[model samples]
Target: MTFSDDLIKLKQNRSAQEPLPSGIAPYTCSAFFKSREYGMKPKARRWDHLLSKESHNLKPSPLKTASRASGQKKLISLGTARPAPEYFPWESLSLRCLQDTVTEQAQPAPTVSMASVKLEQPYDLGVAMNYGFSGGSPQALRFVTEHIEIIHKPPYDDWECSLTCGTTSAIEIAFRIFCNPGDTILTENYPYSGAMTCAHAQSLHILGIEMDDLGLHPDDLDHKLRTWDYTKGPKPSVLYMVPTGQNPTSTTQNLIRRKQIYAIAERHDLYILEDDPYYFLQLGKSKQALASAQLDRTDANEEFFKCLSPSYLSLDVSGRVLRMDTTSKILAPGLRCGWVTGSSQVIQKLVSYYEIGVLCPSGPSQVMLYKLLDETWGHDGLFNWLRSLSLQYRCRRDNLLESCERFLPSDFCEWNIPAEGMFLWIKVNISGYRQTHTASHGDGNVARYLAVEDRIYQKAHDNGVLVSKGSWFIADVQTLKGVNFRLTFAAAPVGELDEALQRFARALETEVR
Candidate 1:
């Protein structure tokens, strides 16, 4: 059936008591319904009159009117109600604006220092690195595909793949091909920021699924599918998740959980974007060891084996899964090399985006990664290096957690012992305080957790410590309901981690106290 017809059927089915889903309200119109009924746009004047009549007839119930009479007040106009400019800090804004104005002009200036250096790889000589293949360099595509095969263990014959600059681009391309603006999409409650940004930019409707410790709850997903606006027909066409080491929550599901999640997707006939960057960074060590070694990076703890977990892509069937993997954490983030593995049709669509867009992923970056892979950890050596890397991170995670334990009050912050990846998602407990003073976030707005990014950055520069705020990974999403932080222990030295954690603990304590 046509979308218009489906929308009418959906509206006719909707109860008056139910509020329209936030993103689905734009398409509801009598003309839209008529367009569906007759397969054409209705006369604008006729539709407008009908809409006007409907709007005029709608009225607040007597109880609602009476309640308003008792206590309701008109919304204060922003122009009149807002505090004067002098009442707020104007200097900070002026200084920041001046800095931005200065920085913008400073970038275009020609530097004399440029003349001192000879090009190791000249850009003007019709460089071999001008661009790679339309999809990506043959070597890069091969490297990415091979990496997926090694990491996900999907049947090499069953899966087709392509290289994108990063997971965000891959997702954006896939989104363009699969959904138009206003198309309904499903995602985990706390999703990766990149995916949401791409979806929002495309004007897609985002439906977030509730999450538990096991990740997206299967029951909640199943319920959403069964009870969704079927009159509109199929509320969501896609499901996106980062099942392992989720960005803001750091929750990972086990094989059983994966099976349930996949089952829900299959039952609902929804496509899955299994974005798993932290898949390899999971620590499989024991909890006791995790607690004791929270600040250590050396593989000293024997208990680390218990923390290892599998990924969602490993369990995918029905060809519905689009696996996006990246080399940012294990290798350098500067490479910006990531790949998508899925059906051949999907890969072709992604390739179309690559061809028309910037052509493909960087050639030098791809080759650099390939060389780093071969030289540092040839073939399956990549796996070995990853294992060693995970072991190293496990100790760092233990240290961060231990530091939290030592420094903060027991009730001040809550965090999961990270199994994989560089970040520890921390939720600050603000029960005792009237106002939580979080200075780490980019903005000092009390509406969200202070990201603590600047504070961590300054600490890294001044005291030799580094960490990331949880706010960076938060998409402009309603599902991220509370204050949380994402801390990275990957870069900081082992000795410095203890000091850093201590500093972090002090910071958190100071915020509340």
Candidate 2:
């Protein structure tokens, strides 16, 4: 099995109580043990720490158990933040009796409010359902909110967070909040298909932005916004992008480019929806390992983390960035739990809509993840898991990368070293793609690019190779002239990847000239 295979097994079976029937511990010698130790890297000596490489949150997030219990009391208390709606008559009467009993005993009986009592109950779905707006449990909000502050180091305390299924829901909510039907959503040239699906479902238009190695090209973004014909439709107010380890392309936007994009957004009045699910899966550790030949594993981890590109949130001074993080990438997708951080204005509207539809994330998912991420691992432990996860994917990434070059026809296909994310984007060069085929699709002599692509894709599928056609992600089919495919390098077994490539190569050879 490849590192990717092993990694999946470890994550899926993480809930297992006993050793696997194989008697091996999950992730034995997983990258965590083999790679560097934990902690962020040292920054250059500087007066203003803002620009320094050191983590803005140099210290670990304090465990909010005790602190938040006290705070939750005040928030839900009388004359505090909006008090939770009064309990139903029967529920309040029962609570009153319990308090009366305590008063008779002359003891400060645990204040038996419906909301506070729910948290004190043992973690149970039924208990979770008893209170909480459709939004989520207050504890969940408290946890993820503090977590966002720790990682992204948002400068404003006014920002609020809401739990959702994942980035998909976050994007949809943002769409509902900031845009109406027919409004356009701008994203990278090859955007995440799922988001596109959601946009199409709402009768919204998707505007594709050109991207480069660093990520969304500032010049292209500026040009697209400045020249966009508003008479044709509403000006795109949202720039939705997966800046870190972007799907399909596996691109990470460097700090400079992120700031550039943010600046352009300011000029254009765009809300940057940073849908970065793979933020923690930092693949640059592989490069760090090679570069730090003299450093130990811990040192390598520090350097790897230090060198990671700063997020858009870090550069977002005006709270213009609505950032979402998921346990799906770091934990399990089936959990379907993630959080969104944005300005109070955006969050209020998002939460208002969220209440009417999928009220909040699943209770069981929140319960399990809360236990795993917080109760069990805490901050340092979670970081360790992320580092190790990156290493395992790195192993898989290298294997498929080498296999692509070896199996594909060198004359037509081109591959680049992808630092992060699951898929490797392969550009396929074909004759007549631009001139004859695109200009006139029906002519027999002119190559039908889509037809040829369908043949190759069908051939691969028939031969047991599932691959994604790059055209599916293109925003402008008319302008895109080349053929390409997005192959997963961080999934499936290594052996399967080799066989899949062999099958893919055969399909290419048989179908394409």
Give the TM-score of each candidate: 0.64, 0.73
Cα error of candidate 1 at position 5, Å: 56
Single out the weakest 10-residue window by summed lDDT for candidate 2.
22-31
Native-referenced Cα lDDT, model 2: 0.63
Name the lDDT value of residue 114 in candidate 2.
32
Task: Please tell me which predicted candidate would have the highest lDDT against the true structure.
Answer: 2
lDDT of 1 by residue, 1-513 (tens): 332333344345333223311110011111111112232311111111111222233333332223221222343323222233233322220001111011113232221111101223221112214334445544344445544543454532345667678887778877776675667788877678778889889888677788887778888889888889866534676888888887767788778988888888777677788888888775653446434443234342222232445555556655677888887876667878787777555565556556567666775575455444533334444544555566567777777777777765678677777666666777766656544334434443434334333443444445444455555555443344555666777677767776777776666555554
- Would you list the C-alpha lDDT of every candidate in the order shown? 0.56, 0.63
Residue 383 displacement (Å), model 2: 0.4
Separately for all candidates shown, the number of backbone clashes (residues 3 or more apart, or on different chains) is 33, 4
The digit string of per-residue lDDT tens for model 2 on 283-302 reads 55343443332222544445
Which ranges of candidate 2 are over 4 A from the true structure? Answer: 1-125, 129-131, 285-301, 432-447
Error of 2 at 477 (Å): 1.9
